[model samples]
Target: MYKEPIFLKPVFKDRIWGGTKLREEFGYDIPTETTGECWGISAHSHGPSEVINGPLKGKTLDQVWDKHRELFADQEGEDFPLLVKILDAKTDLSVQVHPDDSYAREVEGEAFGKTECWYVINCEPGAELVYGHHANSKLQFEQMVAENRWDELLRKVSIKPGDFVYVPNGTIHAIGAGTMILETQQSSDVTYRVYDYDRRDDAGNPRELHIEKSIEVAMIPHVDADFEPVLSGNEDLRMKKLVRENYFTVYHWNLAGSVSKIENPAYLLVSVLDGEGELKVEGETSSSFKKGDHFILPSTIKNFAMNGNARFIVSHPTI
Candidate 1:
């Protein structure tokens, strides 16, 4: 009977490399200039998003997932399987890597790992990011780290807006300065930092580096994820399948006008990137959204239609 979209209030996080672009670009009432992240659609304990509409108003996404499982089609998982975030990197983030599901559960005692994909929202000219490493073996990787041969060991790639990059578990990566992106990933927050550019904290203490764990999990001779983004639809509404993997399936929805009715078999995590739109659920005038808005379409509401000009990043956990 829950027919409306579940809008969630974003929970912002402060970081050393953060900036105010999140507010400037998205019109968010950010808490600080150093706000680096907006956890848009999340259920993780660290920063769960709260429901902003309907009967679930004021409840955190985790509560709705736990108490009202049918909203997500009774998805099988102890924790919500995915998280959606928007990041503003005013400066380079720490070069880091994340563990896979097995390592996360066995060592961190967590339900999931952090395999994520990024859709570049905007970036500065000549923007480049650490994507992987040049090391061909663990011995070489350890030696490079030991010798501080950063320039020789790290692999960098140029990026631009509208580009999609997939960072699988164990992939060493970093988000460079003056860049903004939307990230979708497993609902985990365990990051093993390898390098921090010799940066110090506000207290004048050097940031800690998880060298050992990073070395243990780092993929020797980094492998790139190979996949093609399939584009579909027409001038009115162009739907691009950005990714379809074991964990989740993501799409970039570009709407210039009205779109025909669509059915949702499972719940959907949606983030409006730009422009404005109205969503009609089962022909019910339920919700309207704009740029920077994030919400969920519960499984109970099977059909919906869209009207207006806007772009959205949409995803659903692969069940």
Candidate 2:
């Protein structure tokens, strides 16, 4: 069967500050919704169907979850797999951490934890994002929490285009502006916010903090900080690869009016980043293409090709 990219609606969490319909505003002004993914397509049940097109077509993310459930857990029942979203983080988000699988199942029953990464779309001057932190122990993190010195212990880094940040479960981090990103993560929204720039809600109320939980889950000596994308040759096919020992390996393929083929990775998600293109599957199967759309390559698609001047991000877990 043919599959295509689906654009879902983004349910916004209105803050004291937030753009009006980020998908319509920022996505039109800048690039797609590959930024912070707050009001972005949560992609699944908890996410919005912000954008759409292609074979996987009308299938809601929940439907896909039933099929790809094995990837998330072994039991007949399990937490949904990774949630993918395009984030247009117009401002700084909270510094938080997600519990690991063990902690999640134990503490937050019937829930799975989220470990994620941000594939930068566009970043502005003076932008910074959460990388890691200074504390080396959970007890120490708790102490910092007691004194509210979490920011002092965090490892903040300058943000720019073409950057990749992988945040595993238990790592404290946040997405800072100005940034747009493609986020992929375990399908759970159990985030423990440690800090949020003293910003209030529309009613001027401070957002409550999950201080104790954050202190318990924050990882020490966080090793997956300071991430960089791996650039491939340009000219005919310019590809940039971002790999983390996580649930996904995201890469951008910028190509001229030439054909290219990628083999091996069982299934494929082609999100057109620029221009138009056609994908040729193992059989005579082919699909139309456009920017900001997504399509899934048949798990049976042994081979495929690009037949136009285009650019897209191919995402999949690194087995």
Candidate 3:
């Protein structure tokens, strides 16, 4: 059983639509000027995070999941259920859609789908995203695509800092340019691109578009769900419940001084988004943390206290 917090090293990915905001904001040693994503907490094959501290140090999260079941409260699963990422969109991302769990299992042989939520960290003035589509039916979606009527078929929404957007699977969406967001989602990498702005890669080849797959999975008649965050806390800490869905529950924690509580979930995934703090697993060990730090509080450490002024995006997988 693990008795300490497991800090993970993020894996960065360079994308065509990426930019230097990751370095400018988080102080990450980005691999390229176009570094787009920091896979902060992940166990997917595409980008598994490695434990940077504790006894599990140097072990990839995938290895720990496969070898040490006790660390995750003995949760039985073939793979980790959640992924956390920070995306910097210097240019618009491809308009895309993802399949549901049933579709993913049957068609892609994957264990999870891609229902995701984005916490808008920061964005330039007037930044907008493709939130959903206007197509009333699959046939109409196809017809619009065939006619290249993007203006009439896509629905765009303006966003700003601290805004939360829940994106369910089958929602046709895209991240617009000059936006940065912290994303929490089911651990899946399946994306079906519907549009790419006719942009070509370095090889001078236009990126692939999965028109059939996108139409097969996109929700007919997009409907945005109403998510009003519930707020509660004391003088020292304020908690905003972002969303509680089938796959995971996410929250934003703002700390002014200190707070103590019992760790109740199977495991807690935490990303320090602002300020600095120290976490003490009561009677065990304590560590200092600051912005851009990511760690998992395993089930083994039940009671803990955190002190300092900071903000964190905390989440846990749902059974």
Name the candidate, 1 or 3, with the larger TM-score value.
1
* Model 3, position 309: C-alpha lDDT score: 96
Off by over 4 Å in 3: none
Residues 154-258 of candidate 3 have per-residue lDDT tens digits of: 999999999999999999999999999999999999999999999999999999999998888988889997677999888798889899988999999999987
Query: Which candidate order results from sorting by TM-score in descending order?
Result: 1, 3, 2
Q: How far does residue 220 in candidate 3 sit from its true spot (Å)?
A: 0.3
Order of candidate numbers by lDDT, starting with the best:
1, 3, 2
What are the root-mean-square deviations of the candidates from the true structure over C-alphas?
0.8, 4.4, 1.0
Candidate 2, after superposition: displacement of residue 170 in Å? 1.4
TM-score of each: 0.99, 0.80, 0.98
Against the true structure, candidate 3 reaches a TM-score of: 0.98
Model 2, poorest ten-residue lDDT window?
70-79
**Which run of 10 residues does model 3 get worst, by summed lDDT?**
257-266
In candidate 2, stretches whose alpha carbon ends up further than 4 angstroms from where it belongs are: 1-17, 20-43, 48-57, 64-80, 225-234, 244-246
Q: Give per-residue CA lDDT, model 2, range 127-220, as digits (tens).
A: 8988788877777767876787856787898977877677778787888866777777766778788888777775789987888787677777
Could you say which candidate leads in lDDT?
1
TM-score, candidate 1, is 0.99
